[model samples]
Target: MVQPANKRLVTEAAIETRLTTERLVTEAAIETRLTTDAASRWGAAWASGSTSRLREFFAANTGPRVAITGAPIVGTVTVASQADASALVGKEVQGGVYINTPDLELRDFRIKGDGRYALIDFGPFASRTYIHHIEFDGQQSKDTNAGLGVSSGTGPSDLRVEWNNFHDLNDAAHTRPGSSYKYNFVHDPLVWNTAAWGAYNPAIHPHTDGFQWLRGSGEVVSRNFIEVPYKSVSATPNTNSCLIIKTDVAAIDNVTITENYLNGGTRTVMVNDGGFGLPTNISFDKNRFGPDFNDGIWQYSNASSMVFGSNTWAQTKQVVPTTNGSLGYRSAQPALDPDPLGFGCVMTNLGYGAAATWGAANDARYVRALSGGLINGIEFHVTVSSGNVSVGVYRGRGRGLTHMPYDLVATSGTVACPAAGAARIAIPETWVEPGDYLAMSCDNVTMQLLLFSGTAAPLFRPLGAATAASHPLPASAPSPASPGFRMPILVGTFV
Candidate 1:
């Protein structure tokens, strides 16, 4: 028997479920079609064929988890009213999900702009929202800041954003808070490069940070990747950045950044105070930077207590300390010194690492000399509560056990605990050769030493007691019982 093209045989697999309620089944309900158009034709009472069709469709659907299916949404569907905000608990839409609402969750969609419009705009009052797993196409948008994804306004808090992808965007994300959490919040979004826009214009491109936070605190940014591209236009010849945290009025404080991969940009972080208020209580740990990425952190403002621990860059251009309040080219750190002094270079973080270890077991890691010079100072991200810690230098010769020669060139005084990021201690200058196998050791404390991820494998050696040995025991065989890992080590020179 020849079956009709529209006719189909009813089988057990075809029947999903039996409905108890009796209702008229319309042709649209049974139809299955693929659409390339952005807007879906939802024939409802409030959603007439008009300019506000997209907004009306959302206004009518008050379900907790409203799923927007079919083609893309064309125009801006602004969520302006309080009633509309209350209805959207978990609304799954396909792109163009703008938010002025509180406590909303937007996920699993591709959001493209309409040229000169923002795809995701968190209005002046949005709060407690979650944005994840969305790819934003920002090539069509006119400018960076205006057409950005996730532009936070005055009073939003308790937000967790992760796994979002962005490309060809000028401005990626930022916060405009009248205020700002604990470490409960995490941001791990991705940003790629594109040449859709021109090089730089002070009027058009004042700042195009991949991730900028003007206000609020207690949030964590980790595992995020950002690529900075070369621009086509320029007035001041600006370079696109990976992450920037700057503010004018509200005090920005207590944000923890860890384990981020940032490469190819003008600046990694521009901690701008803008003369409003200095940011305070910020920390950066376990981050990696590509070579020639310009200023690792361009500081416009001073911080009360900030930490740049376990971050790494190329060994050729190691980080240095500066007095002019900017980390240009090298991994120059402004937070390390409150008063300006062009004393020593402050190297940025790099290499494989390990978590901090306390107790009787001493912790040590292997470090290779990049450009051998006088070792004047060394700094490590040490966590402690009450006790004291002693740091030192050593020479070794082995891949495994007996890596370093059992002797100390210099050592720092035993310092007290509770040192957040300002634990940089000066040591007696010791000359070292390039490609030297050097090891950094610390006396046992009740804290952990944060590690950096690197190309080389980490090396560890455990001490038998809490106090560090000035000269370790020379071993013939590799110490199979030693604990090892790669971590950030800065060797500063006076010359």
Candidate 2:
């Protein structure tokens, strides 16, 4: 009795209902799978006690968040000497404090500072220092550099900073070696007023950061909430990063950053070697990144023994991809002050003199590989290019006396000299193990290559002398015990 159109409509409705049911079932399956995965991961983590404190410290609904009200001020106290700092056990006090002594404990304090730092410790070395349960409010002092600043004096300071609130400052903390920063909240950095500063010059205005590790080793940064909002009040870019691991002053090793809620900045985390050496054992694991950031999440350069795992987004819980970048002479050097030319030069064992004359016909420089990977090509800077050059890879001898190239492996055929600048010689993809040596040879002495001097030079001895042709390097290159004055900027690009 129904028309054909009515029957078609009913059939379509039934199909649509069935499709909706299937979609719901699929979604439910996905939800169950995700829940199971999360439970398994969390259960293992909890059982081991590795992530139990991290879960309880930064959980939005259950964690005890840091706030200014938590530090109830008892009275105002000025800590200038070791005696004064040692006396601040459980008192909730105010004002800037200087800490240069060992075995001191500071807790439950509210520091409102207008100076450069709330707690400053420029130590020869301060061991067993604990700072916790404090609030550093820089709202009253808008021009503060950091809430806490600890410099690596002669060695590790061995300071532990935890459970603190830091806000309204340029940077929350600037730490060095032998430090552990955990369970702290650092957010809402001071918005730069461009009108007052005329322009946003980084030298004068200073790009803000949450934590800046200038240099050193054996440091752990975990379970913290660090955020520097993008365009919070102003339009200009004033913040640098939430965390910056830099080796400008010295080499860094054994630094672990894990299980933190990090957000904002130009880049949220930046690890730079500064052409000093490859920072080793640098790990970034199980951290969560927030949505608000001007640039990407993270970047690194010249870092060896690096581990990046289980980093996820806070909103979606999806894994974040690796964003790797390099700086210094390892790639192309930026046009900053104290350029590569200003670093001066050193004579290579290949018979190049201090004046850059090719004294020896066949001279070579060897650099140890900090990581194991397939090298695609060799990048080097030619200060005075006249003749062709060749690159070679060789097996290292043993661990201790492996300064020079031991056994021949692979070599890039002689390539014509390029003009004075950065040049790349593409070689066959060669597999290099960690601690292997990369060697370079020049045909003529006039072919001057750039070298690094001062603190930026490599710590290991890398120069070797050999009398051999450009195509096939010598079987063995003998190196001296002393590191000498210069390090050749011969970098191997990896696949």
Q: Give the alpha carbon lDDT tens digit for every residue of 1-495 in model 2.
A: 999999999999999999999997996697457535644554454344322123333332111223334353343354445457645544444545555567776665566654445444444545667766666666533353444433343443777887677776777787767899976778657766555555655555546789887777889998777867454224466677899888778788888898787876777788887666767888999887754465467677753547887987553356776756422111121122211232221112232323244434555556665544445577777778887777767655443443445544456756777788888777644445445567676677677666543323334454332334433354334444234333456666653
Cα displacement (angstroms), candidate 1, residue 179, comes to 12
lDDT of 1 by residue, 197-228 (tens): 55434455534456777677676776455545
CA shift at 17, candidate 2, in angstroms? Answer: 81
Q: What are the RMSDs of all candidates, in order?
A: 20.3, 23.8
RMSD of model 1 against the true structure: 20.3
Worst-scoring 10-residue span by lDDT in model 1: 179-188
**Backbone clashes (count) for model 2:** 2
Q: What C-alpha lDDT, on a 0 to 100 scale, does residue 213 get in candidate 2?
A: 76
- Per-residue lDDT, model 2, residue 441, is 68
Model 1, 209: alpha-carbon shift in Å? 0.7
